[model samples]
Target: MADPVILVDRPAAHVARLLINRPDKRNAIDHAVRQQMAAALSALAGDPDIRALVLGGVAGVFSAGGDLPSMKGLDEAGARARMAHIHGLCRQIAEASLAIVSAVEGIGAGGAIGLALLGDEIVVGEGTRILFPFLRLGLTPDWGQLLTLPRRVGLPAARRLLIGGGPVDGAEAFRIGLADEVTADGQVMTRAIERASALAQLPRDALLRMNRRLEMPSATLSDELAREADDQARCLTGAEFNEGYEAFLARRTPDFSHL
Candidate 1:
């Protein structure tokens, strides 16, 4: 069956809106959601007319990262597999040619935070909650969060989030360089599009080149590439990853079998 976690719409000439549609779960990532997000990104990569994309979640939520229930019963192998796929999506967004703008309202956590950080420009709503709850759960980071967050917000700040459970608000996110702009509630998506529309007007080739520069890993390129592969394999085997996938298929919470 087709993945149902994402909803896509193109309302403007060169702008595409890809909304995370699983509000009931706070737009948490499951296997289905991950597949849909990757597919949507792949489709956008080939659409020449689409110059910019806006990613957000329905209601007030952005995403809470992986569904906890899915992590409940995963073995080490299952967790590693899940991590690999999540990291792949993060890399795909980073390498995509078209500009991406993230409109974050509330709750950007775990892999969800990685997705938002992939944006060339991120616009966040005032008072929105952004956190990285990985260390809190005794899980190593995945989804390019380990690799990208420190680059964008600095290592010290990244550690603060990764190690200390956070519910960082929008203003602080901007102060720490996590957000490009902070808009009033309900205005994030519109503001993000306005910026994206301007970006869409630029020459495509120039924009793409700039995107590549901004996304290039400052770390040794080979190291980053290897790290991506390594992290993915580890995540795939984790018991949490398996549990999460099973819960998603069964439509229930994960049983935390790996722990």
Candidate 2:
């Protein structure tokens, strides 16, 4: 069999670390990776010995985004199906009893940005980059990003990111509430492990209940995810998305003036 796309490491009895293993592809989330991750997360959630989970990428990169190559010939229906899979993954993370933490090193762009925000606590390296480039791709945010973004940085800041298409460094990430802590470059994973260990020592039942309660006031995650899928499906079939996707492949700026 081929190597697994997601690696699970149990450094401590109560802590489980899930590492995105496609380093050569910048850990882009593709269909296979998504499936593997879902399986791993499910198993971890069912493990009574695990109380906290850390999500990160191999090497210094978190993830680039969805695999564009895998998306080349998708239609509106195909796009919706693909996004729904990602939404399911997000739902799994949100409902898991374990305290989730994200350890970001290099960058988390597009869909990866949404994935990182799923963490209850996020630790980033000083040089880490965070970006939301949905507009540039002529697509709306998916993976429940629309809900999570505002929850992390408030409405104003989230608007700037989704509209401006610029990248934010770790310092800004922390200041703007996107990150819980920042450490020296190359030390993100270590710091994340430490944080996870601390979370593991907390009263498990109380912590799990508190996490669920915190999510109660927000719009239901499932409904928001469905809305995102609808919007993304429409955008995927539009002319603007064609131009944007083509420009990305050609490494040129997308011209959306006509659209």
Candidate 3:
């Protein structure tokens, strides 16, 4: 049997690592890879043991995006199906409550950029290239990137990057707020996994609640005050908070492993 295109590994307790295993193809996401990715993410989402995820790629390369060769010779229906398939994958990542970190070493292109941006935090190497070549191909950006990009880089920068813009290297990406952190090529994956592990140390339910609020920020101060009231009420009454309070007085790190 062939090796899986997406390799799932448990690098740490409560943390899963997904390695895109297509170095010869520059980690291009073909249809098969998309399907596999969706399934893997869904499984991880359902796995109560997993609290966070780190997405990396083989050969120090992230992904070259959709494989153009595999994308050719598609009828209208086939094309739509392809888009819908990838959309499902993108939706899975976007809606996931698990803290996700993406390690971009070489390049993150096209649809892959959308996937990378879906991460709660992105770690890019100094030589990493972030590409958005939608216009060059005469296609509007897909994979929910139109929404994710703006959420990451704000409207003006997102607009500029998406419309007739060239690729942005790691430095430019960091300057534009596209990347949460930047590291040397050799350290990108380590940084990403470390970030995910750190997030995993917190209470999972709290992260889910926070993700809910972030997904829908309040438009007014009163609304935000009500939201915070709801958040604090739920948290303060939880066992995690009880332990945390006791730990604060005891001057020790709270052990949230059981929670």
* Top candidate when judged by TM-score against the true structure: 3
Q: Against the true structure, candidate 3 has what lDDT?
A: 0.87
Question: What is candidate 3's lDDT per residue for 1-259, written digit by digit as tens?
Answer: 9889999999888999998999899999998788888889889988888889999898899999889888789999999988888878877987886889999889899988888887788999899988898899878898888888898889989999988556788888898899999888789998898999899888777777888788778999999999999998999999889889999999998877667
lDDT for each residue of candidate 2 in 35-96, tens digit (9 for 90 to 100): 99999988887777888898989888889888878988899999889988998998888877
Once fitted onto the true fold, the runs of candidate 3 whose alpha carbons sit more than 4 angstroms away are none
Local lDDT at 24 for model 1: 86
What TM-score would each prediction reach against the true structure? 0.80, 0.81, 0.93
Native-to-model Cα distance after best TM-score fit, residue 188 in candidate 2, in Å: 0.4
Candidate 1, residues 1-259, lDDT tens digits: the string is 6446899998577889888889889999888887888999899888877888888888878888888998888898998888788878877888787778888887788878888787788888887888888887888877777777898889999898888768888998899998999989789888888988776765554446445545665378887667567655665675556766888899986543123
Better of 2 and 3 by TM-score: 3
Off by over 4 Å in 1: 1-3, 217-259
lDDT of 2 at 30: 96
Q: Who wins the lDDT comparison? A: 3
TM-score of 2: 0.81
TM-score pick, better of 1 and 2: 2
